[model samples]
Target: MSEKQAKKERTRKRLTQEEKAKIKQVEETHRLEARALRENWLNLDNAALIYPAIGSTEWNSVFRLSAIISEKVNCDLLEQALRDTLKRYPFFNVSLCDGLFWHYFQTLSTAPKVELETNYPCRPFTFNRKNQIFRVLYLDNKISFETFHSLTDGGGAMRFFNTLLARYFELTGVKYKNLGDFDLNVRDLPVEEESEDAFHRFANNGKCKPRKETTAYAIKGALENPNILNVVLGSVNIDALKECAKTYGATVNEFLSAVYLSVMIAEKHHSNTKNRHPVKLSVPVSLRRFYPTKTMRNFSQYLNYEVPTDRENASFSELIEIIKAQSKNINIDYFQQMFNANIRSERNFFVRILPLAVKDPILKFVYNRVGERLFTSTLSNLGICKLPAELDDKILNYHFILGATKLNRINLTAVTFKDKCCLTFSTRLSERRVIREFFKMLTSFNLNVEIISNV
Candidate 1:
């Protein structure tokens, strides 16, 4: 070794007395602060309050965000990246803890384990003791993040995932020129607004009227084993899909929602079960654009597009027109009302004082009887995802997959990256007819589609 290198190693190995004392002091202070955090608890946001009460051993609201990197992932580097990423999102380093009247979050004593992917995606958290609500898994070149819905909505999860990718890319020495455009740096510290309950912040002052929910027609099929999750991904050119949507005089989201409703109608017709109810697609709209916030938690609401029973036989163009008419709800005021309705209930004296034992069963029953029944299926489009220019070809693809619930046997999610739009369908139904029909609709437009599956 060179003389300069040998001297530097010697200095690192043998710290001076002053340096040692300063290091010890810093360590002690950090230890105390961490200890204090371990004892403290955080309240579940207005939307997340029901998850702890309603989540079951069989099913829970889980969502996954994944990216297939161009090269095989280095496990050691991915682990290091996770540790560094959590520092800027301390809220993610937490466990769901049960309390007397409500459930809460507590920072974990240590970080969560990063493991190799083996089991099905979005497996239920045992929640035996201090289990974190989120998990990170890597297999081959793909890095997948699965989290309980209570943890964060798509906007929050995307930021966290993108930040981790930025750090991972930096570690791999690939610098992206457009990295500053999004400004999601892993080196930054946590800010107060990142953990704020934005639902409460943007709620309207007046008692907003909550819209009546429809008891929509449900997707029926032979159930697959509860232990398994089936995911089918269909990829198409974003430009081609957009052109098709444009052909129908519809936006991408409206076009997709219309296609989903058409599938539900066809399913009903083929089954002949005589379910003539409205087929509703629960479309989750991110509130970040309307009510800006930096909170890394759930802050999105659903816009139900219920197909009018009278117009059930309408052509695809007619369905698109129907959806376009309902697009009026895509506004600040509509979401404000949705937010207000939930926040007001949370503020109710009775709900606030109820015991956990009494609240849990009631919440579960209400969720099953109301929430699940109000929507036939869900269609969430993450608009368009942008990454740094250098990372354009570095990421092979992206997928946004939702977990299976008992009522909604199949759900669809879409995400676009670098002009490639991936439409992922996750389901527990062994029946693949609906999936086939959905893709058939796409191909009928002469759009070339490549399919992938983990059935």
Candidate 2:
């Protein structure tokens, strides 16, 4: 046959038995993968539903969790650790997709990648990316894990990071015993409890009247470069901070909240204003503490604390007392009320049936207009992180930071490990006044704080 005719004959050749078998095998693999993906998919929970509805490039709800180790990060080992870690958390490696009526998560077949840390924490997440919801980054001695808020709260993120770190150490030939839930020997399976939608499990239909919230006096300053967030991380002695809290008859969170309120009040003092408007602050209370749920999703509520500055000369002591009292009222009933208010709204006959394409705009409007204006700033303390005694010495410290929102320029987050407490102030505005006063107040209380700022 001529060369052209031979080529045409080859192209028209039918498949052999081996070729047919290979094709069938490939098709079978794909079918299995598709089935697994479908089985792993989950609808967004009650608390998580709002995040995708309102998240934007400028105001995404994302946060960062970091672990500082004694030695520099081993990227190769870390990557392997990530792959192994992700196998156990099928839910973590998910890509979010929009449905006609809601947003849901689909488990990804691709593995999570670890890269050298270069950018700031809490970059926007586009579902189209290879890894949708979270990124693992390493720089020198620090390994940082940043995730979309809808994926998990700080508590959940911390557990994931701790496990990742422990697994990384294991890969690096570090002998550590009792690796907790991160032991690779554990079977790679999703815990039913960990992936549950706890809010739905605990929510009640009991209607709590929505309380009126006044627009807070916003902290004004020259806006920083559009997307850049200024971070000021202060490492304080945990014992000293606890001692200071004890002196004031408050917990560390309560004391810190008081300190933040005082700093806001001090801003007015520095500006020489006698205006007595209340300084409002919001503190996120984890629902896991109230309800017994192992879900690693967003299961937290906020306690909005307002110190009535209308009282002439509201002292720090007075603010602490007011904060303490408000905190006492944040029991199970309070969270149930908060959950009911949210779930009830979502359960509205019209809301549940509305198409997402149409519902997103309305939700965004409500979040921006009503919710965003309620609190001037937020403080989320993940509290003390515990690890096995064997692994504790190799790890140095931990830090948590809440990304800023459009109306709320500044937000604070704290997590303690070992003897050190890492308190991070993340701000979008180009003003250092709030953080500066915050650290100064801690120092004035005789708690020495080593301050570092990301310019």
Q: Indicate which candidate wins on lDDT.
A: 1
Clash pairs detected, candidate 2: none
What would the per-residue lDDT of candidate 2 be over residues 156-225, giving only the tens digit for each residue? 8887888788778878787756554443332346688898889888887786647577767567678887
Which 10 residues in a row give candidate 2 its minimum summed lDDT?
179-188
| Steric clash pairs (candidate 1) | none
Point out the worst 10-residue segment of candidate 1 by lDDT. Answer: 204-213
Deviating ranges (above 4 Å) for candidate 2: 1-26, 38-40, 181-188, 209-211, 269-277
Report the Cα lDDT for residue 77, model 2.
90
- TM-scores for all candidates: the values are 0.92, 0.92
lDDT of 1 by residue, 1-455 (tens): 99999999998789988898999999999999888987777888889888777788877888899999999998788878888889988888888887888888888767777789998878887563478889989999999999998889998998899888888888889876666678667767889799888998888677675657779999888887788999999999999999999998888999989988999898988898788688999999988887768888889988899898898899998889889999965687778878899988888899889988898998889888898798999998887888877788789899999988758889999999988999999999899999999999999999899999997
